[model samples]
Target: MATAINVQSSCSEAEWKARQRLAACYRIFAYLGWDEMIFNHITLKVPGEDDAFLINPYGLHFSEVTASTLVKIDIDGNTLDGSTYPVNKAGFTQHSLFHRELPDVHAIIHTHTTATMAVSSVEGGLQPINFYAAAIVPRLAYHKFEGITVHDDEGPRFLASLGKKRMMLLENHGPVVMGRTLEQAFLNHWVLQRACEIQMQTLAMGKPVMIGQEVIDKHMANLSQASIDPVQQGVPEFDAMVRLVDREDTSWRE
Candidate 1:
């Protein structure tokens, strides 16, 4: 364990790479027009810590984010890295609820994308409609609104409602996903955002809803098999997305 700590502490290069990629994610989401200012958050669990995470500083938009700019904070919202930029205490509430409760969750992304919010506002919540819709997920949680999640008292509901699920539709809000790795979380967010977009656009046509669980499961399995690591597949195009975001802004590297 001590050797591991030394490696983590001494390995500035590796840490820098992690931060750069994470920062790129923030900027890419911002460019995708998914950000709702500081209202939503995307958090990554620290490499080896159990009760710690990295979240956005309150004022910066995702486009301006960089690896170093991300604030390191404990589950209680305490800043561990001496960052002057205050981490969003209220925003941390929902993220903390997940990171603290789920050990498998290394990355958590919360978004306020249009279609997702629209789907969340509906009476039944996300009804899987197409192949994309079928990927909505299994065991999705629907948590009732208790106003903005800032207070610690709200943790129980957040924890209870999430209850070992990857995705949660914040009733009248949007969705949050817990990923075991940064890339997996990113892939999940991509699918979910697309699902919400498709649901919203198609629902406007007044089409029938997809209620078949078997269909959803089938396509979901396909999507899972299709899922692979960006770097592992030699997908230079994956970094292209990061570059696209970097071209827009590089403040995230600070």
Candidate 2:
């Protein structure tokens, strides 16, 4: 196993920081019960490197992901760090498309949690009945399911479906979120997962009270105001989660 000192010595300072954050995010996902065994993926772009990004080693469980174990690869799917672990083909297929096309997107998270998948499979998709759902509805995009998403041809169609939205429901599949920062990406996934869980519970009770579009717009406006500070947008929340993860296990920093 590679130690923190060894890994940090081998990478640039910015890249090392990105690796720690991404590794912490994987453990945070596990802590939140958002991981699906060794599947699903969260990727972050290598700072100052246009075509390079970091992804989890193919067979490692989320909890086992450490900074030193992350595999660096270019958008073309070739490993650049010379790690023994292979990159997941499906993960590369999905994440590479967004990273290559969107210059602003520095982080991407894809999940197959039960609530998210359930919402995705529904004909109506996520309803704006809950706080989280209402906020997401205004920006959410949906892509039709095309088998397993490994083929190279599906990339263009997925990008087309994503359009200008940062959050998307892979129809009958799961949710894929893109962010300009890793903090933003984690927060996006957190809210999206909560929205789906609330929607599921609310629907099971009976008829749901959907929020009016005008009210939703107002709510979103308020949220925008609250998030006016770009530097602090998702920082506090992400830092808090990272703290929680560290309390349990700090090996992710390695």
lDDT of each: 0.75, 0.91
Model 2 residue 44 CA deviation in Å: 0.3
Off by over 4 Å in 1: 1-11, 209-211, 224-240, 247-251
- Per-residue lDDT of model 2, residues 128-206, tens digit only: 9999998999899999998998999988888899889999999999999989899988888899999999999999999
Kindly provide the TM-score of model 1 when superposed on the true structure, using C-alpha atoms: 0.86
lDDT of 1 by residue, 105-219 (tens): 8788888888888988999887777655576657578899888877788888788887878889999988887777776677667777787787778888987666587776776
Q: How many backbone clashes does candidate 1 have?
A: 3
